[model samples]
Target: MTTADVRTVLTDGDLTVVGQIVHASNATLVCDAQVGDTVVRCVYKPVRGERPLWDFPEGTLAGREVASYLISEALGWDVVPLTVLRDGPYGPGMVQRWIDTVDPAESAAERLDLVDLCPAGSVAQGWLPVLRARDLDGDQVVLVHADDPRLQRMAVLDVVLNNADRKGGHVLEGLDGNVYGVDHGICLHQHDKLRTVLWGWSGEPVDPVLLADLDKLLRRFDGGFAEELHEHITGAEVRALQRRIGALLEHPVMPHPRGDRRIPWPAF
Candidate 1:
């Protein structure tokens, strides 16, 4: 189905819970969104199931997830999958199209993972090293991610959204050959809270094409896109997002980590 059709199903179709994503911190349910004959797999995070967060306001994660999708769409980058805010079986929440990732068993030869670990000092030619540490056996290993353009775009989106919890597991290698980011509940805060694992491009010059996209996004913000974002995030948060875009436009360089907590805990 086309993107529009899939979105319609997610918005209006009946959601039947199939199972729970037990690993998720919040209540994340796997469901089938069915509209007559068409059915699509989706993830439903009902607002009622949200866990309280000390930094972020209560029950606002769903909206932030949707807002992240909006920002990604405005940039014309498909870094995020189709996500929508709607009433579901439990309550109003965020629903998103589930991405089927490239199976490692099937694609091992190609090494499809965007983030990975390797023996210290043995980082692959095309991969960028992020951190070095000891493994369970006390042997040195390094954290690394691929130097791919798609992942770079995601890093840019993370900056714009001020994503606070971009763990390595949140990055998915979709079977369709696209890189996608997910679990954006703690994003778009009024204050700076950009935590991500896609910092491989840090301190590098921003791609000219992505800078152009940021320019377009700034124009949209002036054209009432900020108001639309206000429906999900706060007015101050919207303004903060604009400032982030403006700062990037002015500097046109990928940001370096600011503090010790730049990378989220449990990096995987």
Candidate 2:
């Protein structure tokens, strides 16, 4: 289906709960959204199920999910999947199209996980090491990720979103051969809360093409994109988003980690 078709089904279709993503921090329901003959699998996060966060306002995570999708679209990156805010079985919530990922067990040799673990000194030829630690059996292992351009784009998107919890599990290797990021409930905060596992490109020059995309996004913000974003995030947050883009345009380089706690807990 086209992006528009998927958006229409997510926004206007009837949702029926199929199961629950039990591992999620919040109540996450897997559902099938159907409109006529079209049925799309989606994950729904109702507002009532959100856990309170000390930094973010209550009942706003759903909006922030949609807001992040908007930002990704504005960047022309498609880093985020199609997501919408709508009424569901549990109430108004975030609905995101479910991604089908390549099965690691079935395609181990062909799978390209954005983040992974390797022996302490065995980082792969195309992977970059983030840190070293002991595994469950007390064996040394290194946390690493591929040095691929797709992941680099996601890293840039995380920077722009101020994504505070980009755990490795949130980065998916879609069966369709695209890298997608998920679980963005803690993003777009007014303050700098960037936290992610994709720091391999830190201090590297930003690709010129991506800088052009940021330039385009800034122009869209001036053309009323900020107002559109204000519906989901705070006005101050929107301004902060603009400021972040402006800073990137001025510096044109990927940022290095600032102080400790830059990477999220439970990195995978």
RMSD after CA superposition, every candidate: 1.1, 1.2
* TM-score for each candidate, following the candidate numbering: 0.97, 0.97
In candidate 1, stretches whose alpha carbon ends up further than 4 angstroms from where it belongs are 109-112
User: Model 2, 1-268: lDDT tens per residue?
Assistant: 9999999999999999999999898999999999999999999999999999999999999999999999998888888989999999999999999999877788768554779888888787999988788999999998889999999999999999999999999998788988899999999999989998998898999999999999999999878999899989999999999999999999989998887887898887
User: Between which residue pairs do clashes occur in model 2?
Assistant: none
lDDT (tens digit, per residue) of candidate 1 on 207-226? 99999999999999878998
**How well does candidate 2 match the true structure in TM-score terms?**
0.97
Q: Where does candidate 1 clash, by residue pair?
A: none
What number of backbone clashes does candidate 1 have, counting pairs of residues 3 or more apart or in separate chains?
0
